[model samples]
Target: MEEHCLFYLAALAIFILMLVMTFFISSLLQTPPRRHKTASLPLPPGLQPLSVLGTFFALFRRSEFDVEPLLRRLHSRHGPVVSFRLLSFPRPPIFVSDRVLAHRALVGRGATFADRPSAIDPGLIISSNRHNVTGAPYGPVWRALRRNLATKVLHPSQLRVYSPARRQVLDVLLKDLETKSSGGAAAVVVMESFRFAVFSLLAFMCFGERLDDEKIRRIASLQRELLSNFVSFSVFAVYPKITKLLFRSRWKKLLDFRSKQEETYVPLIDARRNLLLRRQRSEDGFVYSYVDSLVDLEIPEDGGRKLKDGEIVSLCSEFLSAGTDTTATALQWIMANLVKRPDIQTKLYEEIERVVEKDAVVREEDLQWMPYLKAVVLEGLRRHPPGHFVLPHTVTEEVEFEGYRIPKGAVVTFSVAEIGWDGAVWTEPMEFRPERFLEGGEGEGVDITGVQEIRMMPFGVGRRICPAMGLALLHLEYFVANLVKEFEWMPAADGEEIDLTEKVEFTVVMKTPLKARIVPRKRT
Candidate 1:
């Protein structure tokens, strides 16, 4: 009787798979009547043009979680811009690796390509039904959210108001590293320290107060849990009405995680609201926070109602995760590279020493006079962008791009790492050479925003570019400068060299977390 039940379950799964495959194939084979004459143009080239079955199987064979390798192969086979579809997907996702084409689509026709794809079940649930900035559609709500962050929180003047928080976090990081390093007698793994430090800083900025270590750790764990399982949760996004029943366990787990996240975050949101109502400031004075902005914001598109607790939680989650993971990942890669190449480290240290006083911490303003420091940060971003691909974008309407027709609602993405490594733009793009950005170098005067031409874009480009770009750059420059100034990073005492091999997590990070023997710099 048990064996019969097992067989029936297996059969049901197979039948469901076949049904999904058939539905996708029929959709691909069916041609809808054209609404415009431009619709006659050919679609971008794809990997398997022979049949829909071939394309489905080809995509199935590739790892669904890691699409970089598949995208590279597709681009090599079919020029820079290519499209691929998996079973049950509504549209063929187009990928562009060519810089010129990326510029044309993302910048030249910025507004047309500014919109994001429809949010899936997990994203919708976590983002409070697509109310947050990242998941919100490109329109009035998106504009309001993005503007609030840019003008109220992330603006330069606003960022400077948080200097005390930055210094406090820096001191905490230094103390933690000092304890772990044990006066240069011990080797330390720095990624955890990097992550916690950044998380603490962002938490302070989010909550308007410095949270206790336990609270910070709890928040960090919850955010990391979401990011670690984010890729696996994609399964629930497909055919959600059916997947919720088929994968009931996973669906339950996602719901439980969201519940825990809300439990952890809502209290802080309420505290901020209460503080605002009391109209009182702590002894340190009123420090504006991201949540404060969210709480006070009135969405004109949504009948001018203020954000609810759940929506605030979602935005705060985005703020903590985005700022923490990406910045920490970049920090690890930069420090690891410095460990591997001491010559470059020495050059950077000398530059820092020249600009900063002896025994003094590297300040945000000092970052400007140090050109070599800027080059090193730029090199780190180019050599190891935290994310290999930007968030997927969709076209607002059917449009002609690069002599091919992109239908309305088609999913579009760009190969960020590939564009930054384009050989035509940078000489020996694979090498970690900061001189490439120095005067008389090939990469000098290169714009990372992809405005004039996309030599490299670590934070993406165009109208929908990362609103936190300025703040992120400041964090990188400030932290990298101080870290190099604080210690001379060296390979671990075990005689093993620093491993730069990357592993993709929430962001692409060093496979082997950077283990370095850090000797405190003896400044005058």
Candidate 2:
């Protein structure tokens, strides 16, 4: 009886200790008490101060598509620069709409704002611990990856080498469109075809092999699934530990998606590796691919360790994804505009006829001679920039910009849509007029790169400007010229108009996908 009493007392003591520990941990996990705003440097006006719970609910109330419009309204009301914080997000991103100030933040003092946000999000789950270039921390590793991408994948010379591959993909795309749009008058959705074409092109460049239509379609489907989930809040992004402990279902779904990605990507990576081995052994002339270049690349930061298979897979995924979605979405938007404005389409077609040979494929080299084509693409990018906000940038050190003090560790993103359509920069910015880029026009001699000054930055500017800008332009220009050259794009039957309403997923795309009645244009 005495021993039993002692055992009960020890058990009770242990239970009480565990309860205290649990309470302490819960308090720590809950949002910390809000920090008072700096007295000297006030954040730009937006979002009234609210408690953590209040802020989370209020901030997330707007859908992702609505977020940009809301910001634009705020910018008009509260000057060009605006800052807001959410209880859930540790650092609030300051949205900059003023062109000169944006240039200063992104280019003039770029290194200060060069780092990507250190967010624990689902989007980064497959980034090979941020080994790939896009999300890698600004350092030696990033430099090495960027250098490799610039030299091996995105260089002008490398693009020249890939011209044949581009032509082949374009041919495949044309054939697919012809078959799909064969039904008379009734329009078919072309977004899927565009996506397949673009994804296949990037996939070929990455893996160094052409896949069958079915296989390519399968890969595209899997990638879309992954990308959709990537942007959504998931276990990996928020409450990482709790997700594992209690949200097993969400955790399992992520794992399954990742597994599918691996299954699709790993084999392609292996095949590419084998191709490299064969090329090394044989005396045959070899063309280098993105994977081939990555295989040869040695990371100085990792003690000259060559990238592993998983890392290769990650890089290839980024390559496939970045190239596919953005270009495809842009293609749809540009084509939608063409369908909506037949006059513009007619002018574009007339220019193509003047420039190119009858019934011939559009080549990358020919793009230089065609300024109107360039302007049309420029206008498409301007009116509907793929992303409303450039990826959020973290300030490495505290710096003042245009009399506003920016604190270190703050997230900053320039408003691509706002800046593109700034009335001060472009007259009638909302109107889609490619002629604006012609000589003596508002955008004439404008520099897309913010090097001289940022007039418009659809591809972003400065140290973090997209390395693939050149390749992307080539894709857009080449495909747009060809698709217009082949087909007379018209609006769908029975008063169905092109809906320009955008919905943000992996990229901002038309809320209602463009379905166009297309007929093969007669060539003389």
Evaluate all candidate structures by whole-model CA lDDT and list the values in order. Answer: 0.86, 0.80
Number of the predicted model whose TM-score against the real structure is largest: 1
Give the per-residue Cα lDDT of candidate 2 at 340: 91
Model 1: per-residue lDDT, tens digit, 2-50?
A: 9979975885566467656767788889787657766778888875433
Clashes of 2: 0
Supply the TM-score for candidate 1.
0.94
Give candidate 2 regions above 4 Å deviation. Answer: 1-39, 58-65, 88-90, 234-236, 279-285
In candidate 1, what residue range of length 10 has the lowest lDDT sum? 56-65
lDDT of 2: 0.80
Kindly list the per-residue Cα lDDT of model 2 for residues 1-524, writing each as its tens digit.
Answer: 99978975674455445545654677688885544344366556775545543443443343533567678688778888887765424456688988888898888888888998774745555777787888887878899999999998889987887777788888888888888887335688999899988988887788766778788888888888777765444434434664354445766777788788788888877776887777662444456789888888899764778998778877888888888889999989999999999999999888888888977877777789889999999999999988888888888866666656667788888888888988987999999999999998999988898899988998899898999998889899999999998889998786777889888887889999999888888756
- Model 2 weakest lDDT span, ten residues long: 56-65
Return the clash pairs for model 2, or none. none
RMSD of each: 2.7, 6.9
